[model samples]
Target chain A: MNKEIGPIEDLIKKLNRLPGIGSKTAQRLAYHIIEMEDVEVADLANSIIRAKKDTKQCSICMNYADSDPCEICSNNSRDDSIICVVESPKDVEAMERSLSFRGKYHVLHGVISPLKGKTAEDVTINQLLKRIENGNVKEVIVATNPTVDGDTTARYIQNILEKYDDLIISRIGYGLPVGGDLEYYDEITISTAIQNRRKLD
Target chain B: MNKEIGPIEDLIKKLNRLPGIGSKTAQRLAYHIIEMEDVEVADLANSIIRAKKDTKQCSICMNYADSDPCEICSNNSRDDSIICVVESPKDVEAMERSLSFRGKYHVLHGVISPLKGKTAEDVTINQLLKRIENGNVKEVIVATNPTVDGDTTARYIQNILEKYDDLIISRIGYGLPVGGDLEYYDEITISTAIQNRRKLD
Candidate 1:
């Protein structure tokens, strides 16, 4: 008694499961896929499969890569002495987009959140510590998101690395974006930026 | 000298090619895929490839299906005598969701559009005619969208099938949708409803 034409419905259901895609959007996308040339559709599908199958996390930085050591980690030109610690691969991408960081990255995968039952132990923090302990790392920059969990995770990492007093550790500053007005910026961002403000010499 | 990570950028670019997915959304989704559990991400990737590889147009109705005839077309209980013609497989789904039609469907895949260079020959109109000529079909309901191309396609099909006067060919009537407001309704929709007004008798 099910009236739906089977394969199309199955595809829509699958598309709906993707993050941020709703039922209507899924339906639209399904229709678009069907309308596409067979080769184009097949290529799209193949790309998705290949992306998942061929990629893996770098053993060192935990960023997605085609090999054990990601391109960034293995690159000879990168500053191996400085590690930019971030919450996710997207944060790594964001930092890379800025073209400011020449140092390598360590992807935490997630930040500490008691509410979400995620602690420092649950993430790649141990791997990061191992990397630092193994060699000539001079600095660790905590570039996690400017959220509660991010701050907590950063603090935890700082406390753990405190034993290595010879190593320098810094945090990326939080504030209203360059073009953003103070009035439009959230209260927490304003307060955090003010609290963490550094004096000019 | 491209500061961007190659594979990550390529993945984001590929994701942006999907309908309605912008750069930011694509980046977010790409990152999400990167962060997902290996099995779950693999499943998503596999689903996309499987959908493309396994699905094809039902030879009879031109709707998407794994089988040549499609489940609906092959099903004995469906009213094969009455063919509800629609623009795409999604339209068939919408009709099914309403639970209003018991007949089998003929998906045109697209409507006639001179602007888009989509002629009657480009769609499955010939296949539909061939089905009707095979002789068991009693009625053909033109259920295309209420757009100009939709109406033109319906009219074109009606004209083409006019030779078979013995067959009953009809277009679904235009009316204000349930819970839709008259004031907010488009002029074309309201005008069409008025022009196609039904007689209660």
Candidate 2:
């Protein structure tokens, strides 16, 4: 029995489960948590719970929101005819941060990856197709990530939407480095990448 | 108004408040939280709240505990006569890892630092003196950090305990680097440093 760890070991284990947080980082964070004021620590905990509890996927665009339609979906100023579909809410945020994309967003929650056992059905592609079929959407920009899975998912969606010839189907530019996660890229690169997007033949 | 930030910014702000987590790290963590399973995210949040709510200071020694006396203090096999005084619960965990000392512990919560506006009264020095006054403690081992502030606090405690002729007062040795933190030091170094402690007088 590693009696040395005691209660703190349990705390480190919990923290280590967080994404990108290794054991060493977890230990540092756990020590910091123990040193924090009870109220401060409690508030941090509450925020996590609140974010999970309050946020839901938008019914129309699939972006995260407190309401089903989401603030962006419900808003009147957004370009209703242009829907930018992406892999996750983080991607939606990345696009929005550029201050250039005024269209609405559709968050797929994930991409099609057979290697990871993720199929097209596993993502929100069906919901996206339903939205496209409903009408008034002039353009459907596939803003999925630059990964193999993202590209595959984008192609699959484009093929499905090709049946609706009246709608313009386009993919976001691919200047973003292959295999680079979108969340780490800056606003300028993402904006330039978006503006220079190529039309898929 | 930066509508792109919206609710995501709130999550990032909360994450940044955590110790050692900067804005970039906080953003990464917030995005990760969004990506995680709702159950896993909830568990992490609940752990934070539970750790803060369920844990408290041991009334006798001031070490963090789920119960008043703490497990070490309440344990029958442990030597209650030797109280290993440390700056925080993290220190207590360090000593416990060594398994070199089979005695109880008293967490001071902080050390004396006038530059940071922390004084002797700010720490648990009075409680320590009171514990010593109970007459059961034969040795009070000051295992506080080895920093300048730690040294000052240890000296201050030694000065206060000088009035009591019946009890033996000792500070952990200073072979630890002058400016280094105790939390990062290894078990062997800490154990050797403690075993080699010399008399202050």
Candidate 3:
């Protein structure tokens, strides 16, 4: 049985509710929290509350933002003519870190996984269709993950976007990661990479 | 530039302040927090605040408690005459789990580590002395972790407690853990275990 007080026990219970955190991790984190200074603990609490309350969805791209149109959606420097669709806001951050994609983004929030109870309507596919309906977007890049669900979602979106006569639809390529060793790569990944091999420029 | 808005960025900063948590984990946790329901997020926030505000040191054992005396200190069933001295509340929880020591506890909060600027005076060593003085404490068990700092602190406490004519002072044994193979045991640990080996029935 745990020896922590009622409040500490309750804190552990609350922490355990988060995804990927188990009872042991929650208890450990709670113990660590109590050792911190009072002001720091208060700041942690304030940040959680603030993030929940302050963040809103970008009207255009559906990415999380402090304002209606997210930082990317509002910024005129980004290439609005090209829209990249991803699975979550975290993906948006990853793309931003690369500084490679200068275009805007549409967050699907999740891929369509029938087994996981996720359907086409659950994501922001409809919003994306409406956003690019005027044909201002010259190309649409489906940058979902390489998982089975991600592939299926990308294909589903591709089929719909193919209706636009002038819209150029593309999916990010599958290949061995830059730093990954060839010996460690799985059979399916190697085969897929070989099948999609391109001519060296 | 970070893609997340002000509150999300602030939350990531605050989360990064936690021990053992890095920038990537903080960002992942922040993204997870933002996606949670408002009430669940509020509960998590409230738990942190309440644990910080409500948890106080037990007057007797110095463990975190909702009340001053704490559950273990006030429980008459425990052997008050056997005072088990430990380094933290977490240690108390671990000892309790073992079910071997059904006694009272003294929390030192830290070991006397000169490198970390911790002295004998920094922990509750003085309070322990005062509590055991002219009292019914039959034996004092030093259950500090088996580290360089912990061993030094235990020896120092033992030297002082030895002055008492009738009091029995004991250090928890140094031996291979239960179910551990001697082949993988370090030299120091194997030698110590051999030196302290008991006569089997």
Computed on alpha carbons, the lDDT of every model, listed in order, comes to 0.80, 0.81, 0.83
Model 2: which docking level applies? acceptable
> What is the C-alpha DockQ of each candidate?
0.33, 0.35, 0.67
Q: DockQ (C-alpha) of model 3? A: 0.67
Best by the TM-score measure: 3
**Residues A14-91 of candidate 3: C-alpha lDDT, one tens digit per residue:** 888876677767777888888889998888899999999998989899988889887788899988999999999889
TM-score of 3: 0.89
Fnat across every predicted model, in order:
0.32, 0.45, 0.80
State how far residue A91 of model 3 sits from its true place (Å).
0.6
- Writing each residue's lDDT as its tens digit, candidate 1 over A60-139 gives 99988777888899999999999999998878878998999999899998899999998778899999999999979999
lDDT of 1 by residue, B38-110 (tens): 7876666556656666777788999988788887899888899988888877667666655556789999988
Q: Any residue pairs clashing in model 1, and if so which?
A: none
Error of 3 at A104 (Å): 0.8
Best by DockQ: 3
lDDT of 2 by residue, B113-149 (tens): 9899999899999998888887488888899887789
How do the candidates score on chain B by TM-score? 0.85, 0.84, 0.85
Query: Hey, what RMSD does candidate 2 come out at?
Result: 5.7
DockQ of 2: 0.35
